[model samples]
Target: MEQPKRLSRLKTTALPTSLSDHAAAFDRLHPQVQRWVRAQGWSQLREVQTRAITAIGGHRRDVLIAATTAAGKTEAAFLPLLGAAAARQDRGVAILYVAPLKALINDQHKRLEGLCADLEIGLTRWHGDAPQGPKTRLLKSPEGVVLITPESIEAMFVRRPASVEALFGRLDAIVIDELHAFLQGPRGLHLWSLLHRIDAISHSRARRIGLSATLGDKQHAAEWLAGEGPQPEIIAVDGGGAPLKLQVRAVVEPPETSPPTADLEARSALAEIARHAHEILRGKNNLFFAGSRANVEALADRLRTLSEDGGVPNEFFPHHGSLAKELREEVEARLKEDRLPTTAVATTTLELGIDIGSVHSVAQLGAPRSLASLRQRLGRSGRREGSAAIFRGYIREPYLAADADPLDRLHLPVAQSVAALHLLAERFVEPPSGDPALLSVTVHQLLSRIAERGAQRADQLYRAIGRDGPFAAIEPGDFADLLRGLGGGEEPMLEQAPDGSLMLGPLGERLTASRDFYANFKTDEEWRLVNQGRALGTLPIVNALAVGSILSFAGRRWRAVAIDDPAKVVEVVAHRAGRIPKFDRVSGEPIHDRLAGAIRDALVASDMPAYLDPVAAQLLAEGRDMFAALDLARTPLIAAGKDTHLMTWRGSVANGLFAVLLGSVGFECETFDVGVTLLGTPSDEAAHVLGALDGCPPIETLGRFVSNLAHEKYDDYIPEDLLRRFWVKRHAHLETDVADMIRRIALALS
Candidate 1:
């Protein structure tokens, strides 16, 4: 075979001698695959691909390929797997390709079909939105690959156990896409249980190959991917691309001389945003990541209006979870088309790699939720060679008058975001903190297990759920208590059989009967926004309009003329400039201590960051000035007009705990971005507060401080003692972290 031109230009970690080795590895692939590669204008395999083929084809152990987006990770995993499947020629499903998003599965299904078809290998898709024809055909044949989601797998196990066994009985491997997404939370726990259950049932050792772009700590991620199974080998592939070009610019709003009008503030903010988007994003294929769904809608609407006013083509679209699937797909499709220069204002929905083609730049409308999230969004840009990945971050800190909110005075958001950008530049991404004790998932899996195989024995249930399960940390006694609470209560979830077997109770049956039971996470009751009987999209019922309320959605403004509560529908008419509604944020993903520390350090550092634009630079300077004037960095606990501020300078979880502790002890307190605030206190007693905090109060003693502790899913079902334990397990490190904070406070006070 002739050496391809692109092969000579390939940049790989492997040395010159290793080029022959890589070639030998490529030649080992099936002849059809070789021809396919040559037909596609031949290029040498990526270093990650070469390593992946070796590990997967050799059948050494489970594999993890950590590479950048659009780096041909899919091809890397599939090439060797397909080769192995062809060589082996087993009847049952050759591979189980699991993706976090159905959209991803659909995209991969299209890409993989031709490759599979050429080799006479069958490929099928199984998801809620997928057509039934392919699934039924797969049921009959049970061969090749089946692309699916974890929820679909749960549903399959519950609804069609026999079919699942028949289809996946001889599964060769489980390839997990966007592997970092499933490393924590209920979804991660659900995936863990599902994989374990599949292994147990199939009695076959299927290799697990995990893939992701932004896995911070490779070791931790590998341990997470290897959960109770044989450890997976890490294939670390450098994200070879252009250097990242980043800038942090503050959208400075005019100062309120004396009580600014709300309407004027909103309008000016929108106008400024429009100007910024038009200035930087017009004509270029880019993405604007809004902090929230409401922000996405608002910004997209403003950009569209700017385009109309300027007589430019409307290239702006809103892409978020609240938007209709068709609308989101339309935006995605337009982005992929070469001629269309479109920009999508989106939430975290578009952060993941979903084959949306190359974006010229990525702009953050506000500070991202976390550094991990920021890194992921930044990865969306700068894919092409000889070009830097452009990231323009816009943080808006409203100008405050005298007597403005103290929080606003802090300018914490801008400081945090600027600090986050610095952290990203230093290549400091938060590693996944694995939380294995997701009782909600345990509850879900319990229901699913019993529903799938009716009347399981208590011991058998314990063995499945406790002994070797993902929730192994759950004590047997606690499991028993959980069972009693779930089964024997007024709203019983499980029924005990005469032979001491467990089955779904009335409530459990009702829950399992619903389609929503397929997922482990809890979804808020939502109302669908409709205009002229056309379904717009759904928002949480909590965010519903109250008769006269107005909100922006799908890049259009709508006024709620009527609301049908029972039907969960909001009837709206086209309107201009309604207040953007508020919705509850998904909780429990805490900021790592590193991020908080970095932000604090940034504030104290003398060097000004070059990435900060004029406004951002001003804000940073103002914050630093405040820090020095108030002597905050030196004295963490200070008093300002009968209000004592305890500058904990800690992450959310720590700050939250401290605030709760103070409030529980009957001190009027509120949480600040960088610290805790106590009201009606004098400067002289600030030392006393610090002294008291030095000896970290026991969590049990601070139980009264914990009010409205209803955060986790299925907490309602858990008993009081166990729930308390759950909260402490997640939030309380009183003896270690809190005590350390107290000592720091003591030192500062001294």
Candidate 2:
């Protein structure tokens, strides 16, 4: 086998020569902070810290610090802000730290405790699990820093609206950790609205500071952080030239003969992955990303059993959203202490920066959801000096039999993995792509704003939540329509008074009164899993299980002895044999067009990636051979028996639009990763249809073919036409992306 090509090393930026410059930055810090730095035995400040001090302390500008993980970004943002806060005599909260997750807030609370204590700044943790004494004290005398999550902020707006002004009216800075996580989702939009709302409430101009390790579009992120404010000073630093060491391993399972055989094949493949992971990573501290909750539980259980069989202490644990807080925290604590070698099989929960002590490497069980995710996961390793960042990827591909589906024979997963590795080497990261008109979150913020101010005019609500807010995609007409629907629907959520102010209606009062209304995202109903009256975890109610059913959870097997339907609790006991339970979550993300193109390129190229093991190389060769044999390079449409496959080579969104277009035109179709399948349609007929296509069909015509339109939390409450508009705006880029795809397919078919 040929040796893999190594990624080019990044050039390190030259540091300033003048010692006086460094001293100037150090002198800008508060005296106590300077002493604290000296006590830690630090020689000089890092480049990011110095730059941040100059930008934040000297100019008092909003800043976005983009650097590698564990590169002192927290200190860079806090030191200057803390110094400024100490210089002020105002009593309100000085800094408002907003994070995406409660765990991250908890981690920062522990990490910043010493610094705040030394500076005599009051630090408070405000979240669901945080103690009430500190919260009450802070409410009485709001001061110093308050670390909180988005949900907590929403809760305050709804439940303690009158007190919000007192708590954050004089805030000096708003520090957002993991800024990229909030860039392009419903949660991001919700946070954006909250930030604007905070600004509206505060008397002081709070400088916004965003911190992230993975930002593909810095300009877009900067604009997001600034909102209507001035553009933030971007402080980006490349990783200190750490070489990446990567390898891709392939696991092949027997062709599926039936449902039972397919299940056995999956188990066999998982076992193989576990054997390899145990042999290689057992004695080292590392993170194994299993991509989903079910996979996390299965892999962790297998690793635990492997340890027991080897007569060694268990070092593997599971961490995900569904696990009980105590169980998850125990795993986190074990990893941080590093008293013993620990390997955590987790989902995206552990991908964020939680100050888990440095690990040896990262293992991914499949192709990562996106290149950005892969980059973030890899950042968890190679923190120690002179150590290369290590990544191990395991891709399970089905054995190609003569009767295999064309999609299976292409080995798309293996191809996708290789493409991601190549893109990483090329320093390519996907930009944030989310719905522009996130009407669901708009509804959430609309109600939140009304509840916050007691009552609001229609124009005031539109301006606050739409025109000058994150939901800028909404037009004035659509805003009016939304307001009308909310104020006059069968189940009105808003009522208009004689003064023309919109207030909470009966249904709205009921919703806003509940604690569950704080969240912008939708959550499935779940049943708690209890063992001997102790909470183990939660399983989605969608997972059907009877009393005799045995399942794996929290890295252990359990038998459901009884399920209390009224209480929504499952009583379980230890069991030796069990199967993994399915959760109501999609395991994959929308593949970017660039990634899809890269996969197509990988299949067509002759040169193989050096990082692939022998088995992986063989799989690539097989895919390439199949690609050539089917003449997929020359045409986008191919006939495989009675069906025709149109290889659009576009992202999932575009392909979904293409499928809908076909279905609207009276052709039965389905979508895969790269293409749409026209069932029972011959190649010639498919080509004729494709060549005759002009542009995207009407939204109403396409809507007839789409399902699951009510995906967002508040989508059901929205008017039907507006809901369809939201779906079309988010899922289908009809006028531009889909139209362009149609033209491309037409030309190819012609």
Candidate 3:
């Protein structure tokens, strides 16, 4: 069925005359929805709600709801969706709700269960942890909204292509939550390819609807969501909420009066924090976001110890991806109950919306990875009415020796956190970048599509996976080269039989058999952690464990009874006071250039940020003094003893290119925090190298030194030439002028 004739009017049209018109739009929704709204005791619709009703209900256009968290973003997208479903034929699934995280989908399914039950709309969630019963039931009778993750969608395409087609034959809409999470990188590209694949298979023009709280660039987000279709009518809503309460404080390892040993001082610092946490956060619902899972474990354990010492209940819990689903769910259940005072020390696992009730405060152990993340973490708190969002940033930088690098010793962590808060205070968020040649995800899709449909012609494949695909930026020549490389190599992934049909070769079949092929996201080698033959969770192989090893996981200690190789399982039993095993949490998104520049600005600026505590203020002053001594603004290049550092206030991609360029010219370089460091070359030698490149060399020429080109799944199958081309296009900021960089280095040497 075609959208309403006046769908375009919703874009270039005037507003409704009065409040009655808006109310009439709401009244148009099914009576069940109206009753549900009344049962909730909501007086009126929010801005996004009204806008969604007007655009989706009246105009019938694809919609992108961009609003703040707790602004009823999910409701804004789903209200129209379910209302439309109410009038449609319930044959196969009517709506497909895709979330980035399984936890998010599970949370939404539970939250919407009441409404879905009230409307009698069948709702089923399918993810890794979800029981097979719902999936099997949905397969038998696919109807209503099906909540899933992107990986699960890929799995459905692979495992039940025919079922997927039948199920989504008359799909009404595709609702994407956390849309910003899928705007860039392999996951985003994978989602785009999956959507296009679904469209091709089902032959249904399901209207796409995206819901997100943080979209850096609205135009880019709209284009990303729309793809080849008409641009989604963007509904940007400003939620009026209470002001934010932000505080940044610094913790020195030891007191200034009596200096202690590093280990002792570290212990004291942890103790001091636990005491402070007890005073400020005890007996209150809150969350603490640590820099890493290890930190979360260490801190939560310390907090538990403190509670035990004080004869109080241990309300602290550690939450991360490695924990068992049962434990994580238990944490969620406790938080939702909101009876006992609880605090979850976590990584980004809990940052997204999970409806775990209102948190009184959200604390950070260090500076957040990005401004967008900071915004999301802040949104987790202050969700209740009349309550201001409270954020406390604890920046702990152990004291370095007096002769240590001034830049490192001045405790810049707190300053950077304060600077980020300043940006947050101004409501400055890093816009999601939509443009990137995702050859990695393209490779995954190429394999997946071919697997779905036995053989695909080169032309049709190109059109469906390239030109008309998410990787539109990828050139035809590069795509052809990639195919030839994958099919022509000694270990070929594809073989062209007689009839010119390409099919998976022996190597391809082996790859497809692996369980990890479903996901486009990069993950480390992990072992399943089992207890008495029951699965507890998984631990990264990098954690270094052997049979009989005892470690802490899931907020409990366990002894590794056995390590089964073929089964890839580590059997463990309960133990006490086990050593905290080394575990790694994948790094967050790369730092944006704006936030990096803000940190640099904070170092040079004279004004003291009001959010900083006395220790942080003192550190900021010292950092300013050190920066002045080095005169880094005019000359970002500096000599720190034997090493020469080129401080490029640019992002990781740009800094990476700069390092590769220097290495290409025989100056071995490596990327450090906010700059590139010449590994063995002298400062003067670095200057000479930079001065020689007055007419900067083409970035592509430096690809020879660019190791690790095969960072993605099938990147190894990509031809070297095309891989380098794609890398330079995606990573190297060649669009930026290099003349300024060259001049700065030369002047520093002089």
Q: Please, what are the lDDT tens digits per residue for candidate 3 over residues 1-750?
A: 454535633434335335776687688788888899889998888777887887888665578888888888888878877877887865889999999988888889987889888888989988888898988888898898899999989988887877888788778889999998888778888889888878786655888999988777776777788877876788887675657887877776653444546667446656667667767898888989886778889889888888998898989999998999889888888888999899999988888878788889999887766888888888788888899899888877665565555447435576568668778877777775534337767777778878888888777788888887457777788778878888976778888879887788877877777789999877644568888768888765422233444445686667666766435577878764333212111123466677767778888888997878888899888888877887787776676566676778765556656665665566544454467666445667666776666645776666655544454556656776787777666544553445466666676656
TM-score of each: 0.88, 0.88, 0.86
Please give the CA lDDT of all the candidate structures.
Answer: 0.75, 0.80, 0.74
Q: Mind giving the per-residue lDDT tens digits that candidate 2 earns over 421-461? A: 88888877788775633888998888888887888888888
Candidate 1 wrongly placed segments (more than 4 Å): 1-17, 257-267, 402-410, 434-437, 524-590, 732-734
- The TM-score, computed over Cα atoms with residue i paired to residue i, of candidate 2 is 0.88
| lDDT score for residue 201 of model 1 | 68
Tens-place lDDT per residue, model 1, 223-244, is 6677776557677777556687
Considering summed lDDT, which 10 consecutive residues are worst modelled in model 1? Answer: 579-588
Q: Supply the global lDDT for candidate 1.
A: 0.75
Candidate 1, pairs of clashing residues = none
